[model samples]
Target: MDYSLNEVQNSIKNNFASFCTKEIAPRAPLLDAASHEQVQTMIKENIKKLADIGYLGLAHEEKYGGTNLDLLSQAIAGEEVAKACASTFLSAGASNGLFGMPLKMFGTQEQKEKYLPGIIKGDIIGAFGLTEPEAGSDAAAIKTTAVKKGNEWILNGSKTFITNAPIADVCLIMAYNDREAGPGAGVTGFLVEKGAPGFVVGKPFDKLGFRGSPTAEIFLEDCRVPESAVLGQVGAGFIQAMQTLEYGRIGMATVCLGIAVACMEAANAYSKERKTFGKPINRYQEISFKIADMMIMTDVSRLLIYRAALAKEAKDPESAVLASCAKLFASESATKISSMALQVHGGYGYIKEFPVERLYRDAKLGEIGEGASEIQRILIAKSILSKIH
Candidate 1:
């Protein structure tokens, strides 16, 4: 129960922060403004830098060519990357959590042997395909179906709002294997390689935030893969997706915390110089109160994020509950704090020239992605009731 970060974690946090400030922060705005091709290039180059430094796989085992760091290190790494640029963080986040971990956990030795080496080397990009046009929070409601045809399964359906779809070399797609068993019980997971017949990448979608990361629709029409492509077993996709989301929530919370910290830092620096009524605006009770609340929330979020990370490292039963709580509180708080920071900046905040505006926009996705805030609350309540009963 040691709350203090060890020397290694402290050094890692410091190193990662320095790297983000020097390497990633300067290009963030430009990347934010670039076209899809330009942004993709920038992200690919940055991913190489991250991989070279061993930051790309903080949570995976060393034998898999990862750093094998614990959850705390992973959280710290995520926060640093997020602080630089939320989109870049998300790009790596998908590779690390949704793609890399699942492969390590459920992929057969052959699957891992085929994928992990390139993934660890940053030679290929990975994506997760679960959400469909009709399925957001209701993951089990996915309509994508994989029907057995001889030795192969034919997949048909479409997914929207998928990040990394445009450039991904591989994807982990979930679909219904037994329509008769209903949503959760009938589902299965599969790894579909790029350029598979009948599998096509759809056009990119314009999004409100995370503009630096490309998102697209994914269409599968009679996309066929060998039975060996199935991940885990039939009827296990729902459970696996839920598990992936548990880890993904922790990563999302860390990203939100980074935004919260950035908002607080911006507000603090502005308050000291902003004058109102011939006095510093920070001297005013109204302005000071907002700053105080932002600071308090940021601190609370950091602790919650750390606690969730610790619970995950310890393999505690409550890790899932903690992860959901952290994601819910930190994301909602980021939205509030970022908005307030913009208010502190006055009219400039509304302008695209200011980073706060983008941060504000980015903060919103934290509430909607991974799992929505409502879903997090439902999960927390479910966990609580289980303990009570």
Candidate 2:
């Protein structure tokens, strides 16, 4: 019930917020002018900067180049960085949330040592490949195949809508190893190094938002890796992938909370300054009510996100369901709150110069990314039904 941040959490949140205010906030506008490749380069530069400050390694042990912070620190950092620049924040989030965390959870000690240090140092980026052209919410339907050939595995087929596809130095590629064994044991994860023979990065797509984060396709045409490259185990990829996405769901919740907080602040500032008839719009019940609603929505979202993060930190059995609920609620709240904030801004909100404009564009992705809203509901329903009777 005590929602107040303790000294450590407060300091962690403040440090990230101050850093974003000084660095990410000022640099976001330049994204409008930067080319696609330039934005990607900017992400790499930001990664190095984060590495220098030790923010990139927030959760891992010291020996693995991390500060060993808890999950709440990551949640706070996600919110703060996203508040300034969702795109750049995501560039890092996908690396850590989707790739690094999974490696930590499922990789062998040797695998961790070989790949994790570069990620912590920002020397290279990592990616996760699960969503394929034929698969979205239905993860089991993916057609990517991994055929074992002698001492190696040959990966073929393509993955679409992949984050960091074009730029990631390493990727956790998921493919069907044995379709006859079914989704649980048939799926496998391969650590595919960039530039490996037959590994191809597709062109980045032009998207509505998060333009700075490069998303593209990956085609593995007989892409081969040593048998030792398997993450965790050959048949447990499905479970690992599901668990990884639980982390990502919490991440997306944090992202949504950040956008909603930004939107609420912008509307509050604008309402106080903009006049209606003679006085400020904040004086009007219409504007005041919207502001109040936004505040309430944001606070509720924060609590849910915090709970989910706690569940993740504790390694709770229900963490997956909690994550889905948190992400679903927070993302919907963001979309609604961002629109209200835009309405408060009137015509100015529609233009690119306003941060609200950026927020509006970025907010929509929350509903679609990680796991779509519909998918979350299904997971929640399944969890609830299983608990009953």
Candidate 3:
């Protein structure tokens, strides 16, 4: 019933915004301009910095060296971090939120004891390997296969566009254990270490945006792991992935919201500072309306994101539907808002000197990554149609 953030959530929002402004924002341009190798190192440093402030462990259990904040609080922190640097936010989430959260949610006691603390401490980097060359949105179409032999599991496949792949110390690899049974009952997830025999991480890709967040391919040819490497119950990988992605969608939305906010700020500031015909551009209706639309989208996206976050935290039955809704709106809004912001800057936005150029490029991945806007529409439409008589 509440529409506003409570005291603790507000405090988290303010504190994270302040810390990110002071520590993270300054490195954003540096990260954007760094070489692939250099950016990877800088992102590692950003991860450690986030860990030092407990941002890496937001909403996780206190026993695991986490801050134990609520999901809404975590979303708040995510927005601030993403507003500072989208690449850092994406990389950090790939580690703790995507990789570590699965372990926390489904890992055995020993798994938690071994990985959670180190992951939260930022001592170990993690990656989630699910999307393959063929299975970008259709996760069930992954060609990876795992077969049990004696006391070990042998895995073989490749994952592309994996976040943090170039630097991950550990990865959760999903594959089919019984292809005939389909993803719901056939798939399994295994914890594979970086140097495991036959497991090779390819060179980082030269990306158009999010250059600081290293993305690469993972090749596993007859990769072997002990029986203890299973992530959760046998035949539960598809459900686990679905569950993880539902939560991840909320994160994706928050980050997009952050990008929208950044766009609005840039546009508003530039409109007031830049002048045309001896008057500030803000006085022009064309410039003023674009800024107005940016403000409206940013505000609306925040509400949608928080609504989804609250639904998720409450374990609402319709949470998945809401998550998709938020993600679709926020992500598409980001692309629109960023373009407007860039247009507001005129020639300066096209140049690398202005952050809007980077924001424009970074805003695009949101619509495609996590889940595509097309897929979101399908899900939302299906959910609605399923309810009608």
Candidate 4:
């Protein structure tokens, strides 16, 4: 299938790149330098800036304060954002892409009306709380429980590594409502708002990277919510979470692509400017080959991202496998490309002043987030074996 960008897609890429370079990229260093509280404020401002341009709503329908663009357009915009500033990309992606997509896909019309508009506008930040203290890749093992008590459900458990936890206005919490029903049929999702009784947000964690995106622990000590807060129906949360991750995988892959592109550009530009042995480093085969490989890798990653996005848009069942493949390849490529790109810069790349330094840190999360490289291989292999017969 053709992967060429149409006029609209090209336009989105150009426009988003320009906006991110001018508006978002400049703030990345400031974010990296700021304190936790300061970073939180800056992250909110970044989301609003994107929202003002309707960038946050690219993939969502217009009825919910969105622009109704396709998933490919969303991926393109995400790549630009990540390239400009991986930290902003992470925080904004969690709020708009991760949190909003699930609600759009499963929430009732009323639920959408209540949350989507505020979320898309960036007025109300959102977060997805699925990774618990014990349940990460094995999401089915979540210890959180939602027990029915009269007209309300009482939730009790804790989630760690929740992005946007400190500032989330609303959070979609996953828990087992009927443990006896098994993971496939026992789990349920709940829409819990900020300040709900027994819902406590812990202090933001000092992370290794994506520092501007505040991640923290969430404790639900007998958290109470009305029946209306249930996301879709009982015994559906696990399925909803898995399906939502498919879209998230595509987004994460695009984020990795942005980091890879940034590293490649930085290294390529430095190669021409930095002189060694009476000539530019580009003259050396070692440097030039590294740059070439970076280019090739980025191109391949982009193609995979597009393929996955297209598959998702068409509702292809293979979309899940494609997404995992994209994430696995792009994330690993980004780390390798960043390392080589930094090497091309020599000692200069190791400095904090260089974008590659921060990008190097940001590239790592892609391998850990979404589903991790190992998890992705399992998924891809399982899908392949299922078709072998």
Candidate 5:
């Protein structure tokens, strides 16, 4: 029930905000408009800056050159970065905690030693390859297969809609080792290096939002990796992916909360300056109501995100349910609030000059990625029914 952030968390939030304002905010638009190489250069520069501030691995263990902070701290920092540019935030999030955490948590000591240091240092990027062309919400039905061949595993399948895949140096890929055993018993995870033969990354995708962060399809054709690359035990990949996403949902919700705040601030500022009927737009009940709703939704979303983070940090069994609830409400609310902010801006909102337009685009990805709002609702219902039964 305690919602107070500790000193370290507060400092982290402040430092990240300062860094974003100074280093990221100014060039965000340029990066969004730049060519692929230019965008990559900008990302590298910012990532180095982020690493210098120890923001790259905020949630990892201190023993591995990380801050070892709790979930709330991670969420708070994510919010700051996301507020600057959702794509940049996605880049950092995927590298630090989303795809890398499971490896750090379940990988062998050799695997950790090989990947964790580079990831923590921000020298390399990582991605999770779970959602395939055919399997997104039905993760268990993934058709990617990895057949055991003596000391190596032959992986052959394609994963689409993989965030950070285009630039990732490593990937945590999920595949079926035994189709007959079903999702829980047949699935396994592998640590696939970028240069491994038969592992090909497709071209970057054009998207509605988060344009700075590229996503693509990853093709694994007879890809062979050592048995040591297997993460945890065979047939446990589904659970690992689910567990990782539970944590990822908290981060995604935090990003949505940030977008919501950005929408409200922009709307409030514009309403005051924009005049109608010989007075400021704020005088109008219609505009005022929209702003009020935006404020209310943003605040509520923040609380839900914080609650989920707290539950995760406390290791409560309900953490997954809370995370799902937060993700569902906060992401959907962000979409709604951003749309309203655009409406408040009138013609200006639709133009590229205003940040609200970009924010509106960014807010939509939250509703679709990191488990869609519909998927979150399904999770919530399952959780409730499980308890009831």
Candidate 6:
């Protein structure tokens, strides 16, 4: 497989790199210290900036005001942005990946026109509510219910650890329409707008990193939406969520790859400058070896992430397996590389003085979110075993 990026892809990479340096990097630390409400405000403001630059819709349809870029381009955009700030990347990338992509794939024409423009135009923020207190990875076991009431569907449940939930203007929430039928046949996705009666958002939770990106619990106490709010078909939400997650895992791989690359960069630069025994630490075998390992891990993660994104671009049959492979490797590599990067920075890394500390904290989420490492392994094994059978 070719490793070199084409001119268009390179252009996307360069543009986002510039955006990160000029706009995101300078603000990352400040945002990290901001209050949750303030961060939510910045997320909305950042969305407008991204939309103005024609980024929010890069991989969407041109008729819907997107640039019509491919999945690889979108991944490149995310990779660059994440290098500067994980929170910014999560906020902006989720706008399209976790939110817009599903709607595009499943929503009706009216639904598309009604919501996509505002999202693509940065008029509203979007969220995906699937993980519950009881349904983190075992989504099939989620107890959230949606019962039909005349021409409306009433949703009743709670979702936790939901990023963007606190300030989301719109959300795609998953619930079961038939408790006896199981998720495969009873699950459904609903488009719930902000201020909907009975839809309540909890206070944002403080976290180790991605401080500017908020996560919260949401309660749907008989929250109601018209039948038209159903995304795709009733009893199809589980499958739709699985497919959406495959693509989201690809985006997440790039985000983790970005963090990994940042780890390598921070370690490499620090090693050269931090002197030991009146000489640069980079000269020492221990320091050099750490850098070497970090470099290798980062590069390998890049290969895996790009491979998955390119597979999606080419419509490869192995896209699902590759996405899981990429997410698993890249996320774990990020944690390892970030920890090493922090170690290289010594005591300084333990504080907010350096970006490595933030990266170190943010990297942990890579292993846990989208899908955990264990879940990815299960998916990969399932893929291989199903083929053999």
Candidate-wise lDDT, in order: 0.87, 0.88, 0.91, 0.91, 0.86, 0.87
Candidate 6 TM-score over all chains jointly: 0.97
Write the number of the candidate with greater lDDT, choosing between 2 and 5: 2
lDDT of 2: 0.88
- Looking at model 3, which ten-residue stretch has the lowest summed lDDT? 1-10
In model 1, which residue pairs have backbone atoms overlapping below 3 Å?
Answer: none
True-structure Cα RMSD, model 4: 0.9
TM-scores for candidates 1 onward, in order: 0.96, 0.98, 0.99, 0.98, 0.96, 0.97
Q: After superposition, how far is residue 99 of candidate 2 from its true place, in Å?
A: 0.7
Please give, for residues 1-389, the per-residue lDDT of candidate 4 as tens digits. Answer: 66678999899999999999999999998998799999889999999999988888886889998998888889888999999998888888888877898898899999999988888898999999999888899999999999999999999999999999998999999999998997657999999999899999999988878887899999999999999999997889999999889988988898899999999999999999999989999999999999999999999999999999989899898999999999999999999999998899889899999988888888899999988899999999999999997
lDDT of 6 by residue, 224-263 (tens): 8999999988889998998889888988888898888888
At residue 199, give the lDDT of candidate 1. 87
Choose 3 or 6, whichever is better by lDDT.
3
Q: List, residue by residue over 274-327, the lDDT tens digit for candidate 2.
A: 997999989999999999999999998888888988988898998889999999
- What is candidate 1's CA lDDT for residue 241? 86
Model 1, position 140: C-alpha lDDT score: 84
**Which whole-number lDDT from 0 to 100 does residue 330 have in model 6?**
92
Show the lowest summed lDDT stretch of 10 residues, model 1. Answer: 55-64
The sequence of per-residue lDDT tens digits that candidate 5 reaches over residues 129-188 is 999998888888799999999999999999998888878899999999999995657999
lDDT of 1 by residue, 1-389 (tens): 67787899899999999988998887778877888888778887777777777887677777778878888888988888898888888887787678887888788888887877677777878889999999999988899999999999999999888888887888999999898996588888999988889889987777778888888989999999999889977778888888888889999998999988888888888888988789988898888999999999988888999999889889998999999999999999999999999999898789888889889988999999999999999999998898894
Pick by TM-score: 1 or 2, better one? 2
Q: By lDDT, is 4 or 6 better? A: 4
lDDT of 6 at 195: 88
Q: Which stretches of candidate 5 lie over 4 Å from their true place?
A: none
The TM-score of predicted model 3 comes to 0.99
